[model samples]
Target: MGWPPASAAAAAAILCLGLLASAWAASAAAAAHGPRALAAVQPQPTTHGGLGPRSRHHRHAYAAMMYMGTPRDYEFYVAVRVMMRSLAKLGADADRVLIASADVPSDWVRAMREEDGMRVVIVENLRNPYEGNLGGMNRRFKLTLNKLYAWSLVDYERVVMIDSDNIFLHNTDELFQCGQFCAVFINPCYFHTGLFVLQPSMEVFKSMLHDLEIGRDNSDGADQGFLVGCFPDLLDKPLFHPPENGTKLNGTYRLPLGYQMDASYYYLKLHWHVPCGPNSVITFPSAPWFKPWYWWSWPILPLGLSWHKQRWDDLGYAAEIPVVLIELLMYIAIIAITRLARPQMTKLCYNRRPEKQGALVQGLIKLAAILAMVAAYTIPFFIIPCTVHPIIGWSLYLFGVLAFSSAVINAFLLPPLAVLTAWLGMVGMLFVMAYPWYHDGIARILVVVAYAFCSAPFLWASLVRVIDSLQTMLERDPYFPRLSEPAQETEFSKLF
Candidate 1:
């Protein structure tokens, strides 16, 4: 009897194993067939290249890059190497000219000659490109010299002048297609940057280079200030502002943002202001925390990490697999717990005083307001600890809640007048602490002002509400002020 039961159990286990083996074999066969099926469906690349009946190429062009200023003392190595790599990837036959505003670094010079072995010219400049605060007019002046120097040497008849930060994504030869003398560029600023193409004109170049100087607006973003002033005078020079979408079709994201320095700041300029040129992508992936974006120009991410989450590639330190896995697991756990707890919490807080619909709407609005505040202020401050400590955080958070509530109530009543008062109150509060007049009496005044601001928001909110209520009563019910009497009405009109 014991033998019978044992034999039966062994036989059953063997049968199960065989079934599993068969299933595994079938799965493997299916996978083998799957890729072949996909291969049959996918199209092969055509040999004719992109110059087909529907070719987008308009004309051939080249850019003259005269940004030979010395790289920031610290960033020279990595930045220059990244530039080389970007250039190598763009391939040979790219119409490029590299010029410098100062003595080029020894290593960069070596790489330009040996490692790259590509055709990049390094020209020395007439003046110290780094001299003076090149903020507005001064910046424009330097740029004019820089461009004049580079363009005069450039063999290409028409070319673009780009900063070191602007790197190539593709052979932008097509920009020359419009047949216009002036080649438009993707303006990195609202006005323009030197990264543009123009048919080298002795007259235009001479005038700009000769008289380019400072202007009010103090306009020192570089010789761009000069461009702004000159564009109107040279109205006959063809100027093309790129469409709002900029350049999307060029596989432009991965373009090197800077051949010299990290150009994250350059990216912000591009994002906020559409320059006159048609450029694609910038050094920074600029979408804020909430949006999902695929800026194809990215440092490689570790496998399975979301692109945004993987952006720490610039840190240059790779995260371990186990650490990444543990973080993933922790995130999953947190999400699960949050989902499970939310309904329970909602039930507990539900049905208090308001109906479900009203409560939901109000709750959503409040949540949006809180989230906006958290995103705009809290998250940024949280990066550094001074403003992020428990005491400071709690105090500001509480203050925001109270102030937001007061503003909401005020809006519901005397909305027009109340909003302006509330805004002024906020500006006063912000400056009360942040502004610096740099004198003893001013310091004392600031302290007193801070104290007053801290106390006055709630008070002002309440007083505004009271005045609003009084005004409402005066409008809806004449008996409150007895203004309905003929004599009083006449007197009121006369006083008004």
Candidate 2:
């Protein structure tokens, strides 16, 4: 049966309300230790008189900028743009929104410029830094570093540099109150940069630029790596709180993952006891909140709202309107696909195409199986880490990804290959954990390999879904089978 609109609408409302309520209960329970006045998007404790009522009447919002430079489509960019626009509405100066890309469609550029006052910056001369290099993002990372240096001149104080996948839930003026030379947020668990709040000084920002230039060739291509290594001095701020558990404050050891910013949420929100007044301005990364987005992680909605909850509350029905629109668009897409495919289905019926019937059934079965797998995957995702020790759970998680991938390549069937891979990874992890901190021999390399195994699944699965989906689609389509390169035949896709 087709999903009913009213039902979908009700479900969305219930889901939203449940999530918000659950998150709020979680926050309120945590906050019971101490009460906090709702604050803007700054790094201050709420008990410190968040945003002075007087400042609300007189405060000027700082100009913040972010970009989407990835090869992925513009959905993440659009989400970030929406977030930036939300920032503008929060009783502050909403000027200078910039979206950068290498080859943005003119239509999109025109829409953003004419509508949102966003300038599109494009970098076309980008190339890999090493022609003979294998598995190195050094050149591109270096070029991006150079570009950040160029962006420093934009002259915005307390720049809240966020990923293009982030959303803003409040007035960002609170970030500027930070008088620090610079502010760097390490997810309570790992010192990494999915997001950062930078106090812009020609001196500080320029020094960071220099660091990026120097570390451009380092094996680690993270901008965070350059900042951590060169600056030596960093304003590590506590950007989140996980009050649900006794992890009073998460501490930063080395980044558990590579430059990648994913971390155990409960671990990431523990307080670092960094010295700062309750109302200090700061930055939060795109992880921790674990926004239920399909592409990159979503902004920490609670953090985003905690900082801008009032502005968001003020948004009223307006916020609901966009969500409703998105849902309606999805509904429209569903209807369109169903109607168009019906005609094709009718033709197949008249021709009595047995192969066509099998393909259609196979595609539907594959889709059903994929949905089931995704549901199963969600169980481990929510239950793990918070329940299991992060290091141990993360190891299991690393194992899970490879198992899932094997299933994908083998047409969604549960593969024996996955169980073997998991056992192998678990054994490898035990050996590595046994090593001394400064192991001498393959033992050290084994530790690194084990760590890599722990992170490999999510990293691999995120990147390979589209490729895997295309492979499945090609296999199911008789027309695609006749093509020379089955993977390249998505252009003939009749199934949306």
lDDT digits (tens) for residues 302-329 of candidate 2: 2322323332342222322333333234
Tens digits of per-residue lDDT for model 1, 1-496: 1112333443344334333433443344233212111111221232101111322221222333333222122132333334434544555233444443334444444555465442344433434233465744343245344555433532344445554333444444434332223322223432344344455445555454455433223244345554555543333333343335433121111111221122343322222233333344233222222111111122111111222232232222121233223323433443344344443322222212223235455455445433433332332122211111232323333333333333223222324344345445544554453333434334545575676767677657845664555344223312112112233345444543
- Report residue 416 deviation for candidate 2 (angstroms): 28
TM-score of 2: 0.38
Judged by whole-model lDDT over C-alpha atoms, candidate 1 comes out at 0.36
Worst 10 residues of 2 by lDDT: 46-55
Q: Candidate 1: lDDT of 274?
A: 33
User: In model 1, which regions exceed 4 Å deviation?
Assistant: 1-88, 118-124, 127-145, 167-170, 178-190, 201-207, 212-218, 233-496
Shift of residue 400 alpha carbon in model 2, Å = 27
